[model samples]
Target: MDFSTPIMIIGLVAVMLALRVPVGFTLLISGTLGFAMSRGLDSTLQTLGARFYDIGSGYSLSAVPLFLLMGHMAIASGVTDDMFKAARTFVGHIKGSLVLATTFAAVGFAACSGSTTSTTAIFGKVALPEMMRVGVDRRLAAGCIATVGTLAGMIPPSVVLLVYGIIAQESIPRLFIAGIVPGLLTALAFGIMIYVRVMRKPELAPALPPSTRAEKIDAVKSVWAAILLAFIVIGGIYLGVFTPTEAGAMGAAGAFLIALFRGRVTIDAMKNVFIETSKTTSVIFIIMVGALIFTSYLAVSGTSGAVSAWIVGLEVNPGVLVILYLVFMLILGLFIDPISVMFLTVPIFLPPLVRLGLDPIWIGILVTKSLEIGLITPPIGLNAFVLKSVSPGFSFKEIYGGIWWFLQVELIVLAILFSFPELTTWLPDLMYGG
Candidate 1:
């Protein structure tokens, strides 16, 4: 294959998507054509088998559906609602605290969710209204909830990070561990930003009256559903009693229990939840398959190795090349969905990274972190769009504007992570006893 085949394939993908074609289909069609153009029709067909087997037979991929089912069940069962309600009560008393609470709460919520868009949509509906009613700034409230939605991908149990781990051949446990401090740090950064805004201009946030001790306790009791579910799912993963897949099953079961006992999820709703879960899981797997096809094509064409060599020939330092890759991901993220970007780039990009002897775990964290920031970055922040659907009286523009500072904060956080590999490595080392 010519050097330009990969670039042409990528450009065509953007054109197809720009014309509003479906994303998965765009990937499949582009990848297939790329293969056929390079290897002819017969070999493209042969590549299909290996693509399906690679993604289908993945034990780690099994965790995707299972965790997704858990999220669906969590929504259906009202566990999500309970958790946010608790967040409201706890944070409502402070000025602009509700907005801060959304960021704080999302870290908890992301522990169970798989999709960044879904997390934004769910919390936008659940958290935004309460904040608005409490006289929180509409844009601020909505953006925090939406942007933190990306936390669904940043924190442990994040399906995106799971996929990156699989593609990069990094440890799942390490990826999970690497995200913890950074996730919380991002949330804190958001919280501090919110607090400052409310402090400087009191009208943007009006504090709820102080809650009595009894009120606080009662509110705590109200959201135990979220806490319990998180404990069972996240806590279980860290305990090693079950793998991420088993934890997902356990979370699904747990979500069902929360709904059944609380009389929140009905028989009618339960069916829809299952159906949605299946649809989502299928879409993800298909994307995974498309990505594999493209990767296989790249491998066959020798484009991946050639690209790595070309990159090495750029004559800048290896670390500089890594930063360039990060910038490329950031730019791509502004225009495309993170998952598709991951599939399309990781396979082609990983070889160069490993060749440079960069730590795979560190690279995985960097990829996930950059993508997580992209979820809220402008031009086409998916989380912002998700929030648009549910934010009471806000426009996408306002949400985008509100997130600019937070975006800067995220960039700084990313810089720190990139500069100090130990930020991501220490927990994994301590946990693994290395």
Candidate 2:
């Protein structure tokens, strides 16, 4: 097979993406055509049948839907609302309280909800109005909601981290553990940015009446169950009491029970939860299957090996090489969705970096963080667009304007992760003795 064949297939995928084809179909169609051309139709057909079954039947992949179900159940249970209220009660008297509350609330919510768009959409509805009612600046409010939602991509139970673990064949539990510090640090950095901005401008966020002692206690009471559930899920994984899939099942069940106890789980809500889960799960699985097929074609065509060798032969500093790879992903992320970028690049990039003696777990976290930045980036910023859709009053300009501050904070966090791999590795190392 010609090396150019794989390059051509990648070009074809890009062209299809540019034409706005769904990502799964683009990968599927391109992989099918490229594999057939390189390895004959009979072989391609056999491979396709095997790839779909193998990818779908993987035990690890089962965690995806379970985690997603947990998120939907949390949403239905009004756990997110309680989280926001609790955060507000604590921070309401501070400058930029609403924005700070949203950031803190996002940290709690991100533990349960792994999907960034879902978090953004929910907050756009839940927090946006409260901020608006309190005379928060539209740009700041919209930007804060959109940017903070990316926390879901970083924190525990994150679907992005889970997918990276599966693809890179790393420990899912370790990846989840590794994310905690960086995720929290990112949240804290955003909070500081909000505080400073509101301090300088004073018009961006107005203070709310301070909560009374009873009100503060009540706020904590409202979210204690949800907090305990999160602790159990994360702690179980960290202690090796449950595998990621089992932990996901426990979390989902806990979420459902939370909803049930709250009387939030009506027949209609249950139906919606399952339907949404199926839809998200199907899309993710299809994309994975398609990416598998495409990557298999690249492997057979020797594209991955050839590219890895060429990259390694350059003798570039490992740090510079990693930075270049991240920059490439960031550029791709500005247009392509994060998952698609992961599927398209990870196969080609991981080998060379590992050869350079870089840690795959650290690399995974950096890649995930880069993708998180992509969510709020311009033009095709999916999170920003989701925020805009739910917030009809704000234009893309206003949303992106507010996002600019958070973007700098994201880059600083990314740099910190890169400079000190220990930040990403410490907890996971402590837990697993790595």
TM-score of every model versus the real structure:
0.94, 0.98
Clashes of each: 0, 0
Tens digit per residue, CA lDDT, model 1, 1-434: 45788789979988998997867788888889999998899888888887788777888888888888878877887656766756767887776767766776787778767678888888878877787677777667766776888778878778888788878777776777778877887788878878888899988878877667787788688667767777776666665667777877887788778778888777789889989999988888888887788677777778788888887667778788789889988887876778878988998887777877888888888888898787788878777777777764788788988878778888998998899888888877876334
> Which candidate leads the pack in TM-score?
2
- In model 2, what is the error at residue 51, expressed in angstroms? 0.7
**Candidate 2 TM-score versus the reference:** 0.98
Task: Give the runs in model 2 whose Cα sits over 4 Å from its true position.
Answer: 432-434
Residue by residue across 108-214, what tens digits does model 2's lDDT show? Answer: 99999889989999999999999999999988898899999899998999999999888888899999999999999999999998999899998889999999999
Model 2 Cα shift for residue 12 (angstroms): 0.9
lDDT against the true structure, each candidate: 0.79, 0.91
lDDT computed for candidate 2: 0.91
